[model samples]
Target: MCDGYVQCNIVALPEAYAADFARFCALNPKPCPIIGQSNPGETNVPLLGDFDIRTDCPKYQLFVDGSPTAELQDIRDYWQEDWVFFGLGCSFSFEDALLQAGIPLRHIEQDRNVAMYNTNIACQSAGPFSGNMVVSMRPLSVAHTIRSIQICSRFPAVHGAPIHFGNPKDIGIDDINKPDYGDKVEIREGEIPVFWACGVTPQQALRAAKIPCAITHAPGHMLVTDLRNAELATL
Candidate 1:
């Protein structure tokens, strides 16, 4: 019910595949920082709050053998006894911090989701999990860029800091307006595009793994937890 708190990206898979997924997150902490995880068959994550994993999130993406099969509002029907849910810190937490520090976010200003792209940067493979890094972009002035880095560095759990800034092509992003995921926002003449490791890394891994069945939060529609955004700050 709270919108001000940090919202997390969710990933649920069978116990048979959970270990590999955990390793994948460990190998790619920037995009897959694990904030909370549930025991096999349990939907509750004691660390985040008292909430049902199947029903708490607003949206879910169902993948069958690695391909996205459907988008559902609730995943009650897809629940399995061996399923383990992982809660990954999302960029939304740091976005809040940035806004509070007067660092304007073009995506929010334009009423659109932050632009995200699949970068050529390869992630360390863990078992069957392997994929290119994915990043979210925000256009900011040179001054705000430095301030954002300082502010976001305090929240490591939610993707600590900007990974790349300035020329999008440096990260293999061919076009500023064309994003692999999420909506595109404006980039003013003086503003440089800043990129952050995104929570969508697991989703990309899921596609690469092609497991029989996997579930993840739909891009942008995150799990709103009881944990406050301020609580995520390590500094």
Candidate 2:
């Protein structure tokens, strides 16, 4: 597991809303492609095999009143009997695809989190879950940009294609250097910032609903699933 490995983005919510959220992901495959789910009262994700929703994630974010209150290493103590787990595709799975194909990412080299932003774009709501899309950014040359589009288009399980690129302000981001989440990287000369539908988009939806309580993997600390990235392709 060098540079190219499938990384999973995960979330766990009340079983009460799991079904609707699952259905919503089905309805909106591009933004939310759910790879696995766990039943109520279950701490393990069977689909992911040997995965513990509470401890598998390297970092956890506890949300109260729709806002993050603390970042923890594990959430076993807060686990609820009604909780359900969800595993979604992350852009990290495709980072290997990009690098193997010869694209260079500044943040990865710098060992930083991918820059994320809240866009003016609105997602189709499910029940009370709705909000503007959140996206992760990577800067690349024009040639690599087109090449990445072709490469990432094959992995629809993750955020499939670029929603927007170029000037960040157009996407409601005032400063590309100051990301709403994660650390920003240098945008090389002649390179434009590319945006992808982040798995974090679902968290935005969760916050908009103002759920009583919820938990999610820290932005970059995702679940390492049993399913391989190659197995996620439709073709």
Point to the candidate with the largest TM-score: 1
What TM-score, to 2 decimals, does candidate 1 have? 0.97
Q: How does candidate 2 fare on TM-score? A: 0.90
Off-target runs (Cα >4 Å) in candidate 1 are none
Candidate 1 lDDT (Cα, whole model)?
Answer: 0.90
Predicted structure with the largest lDDT when compared to the true one: 1
Clashes of 2: 0
Candidate 2 structure quality by residue, lDDT tens digits, 200-219: 88888778777788898887
lDDT digits (tens) for residues 47-161 of candidate 1: 8988999998899999999999899999999999999999999988898898888877877887887889999999999888999999999988999999998998999899888
Q: What TM-scores do the predictions have?
A: 0.97, 0.90
50, model 1: CA deviation in Å? 1.0
Worst ten-residue run, lDDT, model 2? 1-10
In candidate 2, stretches whose alpha carbon ends up further than 4 angstroms from where it belongs are 1-5
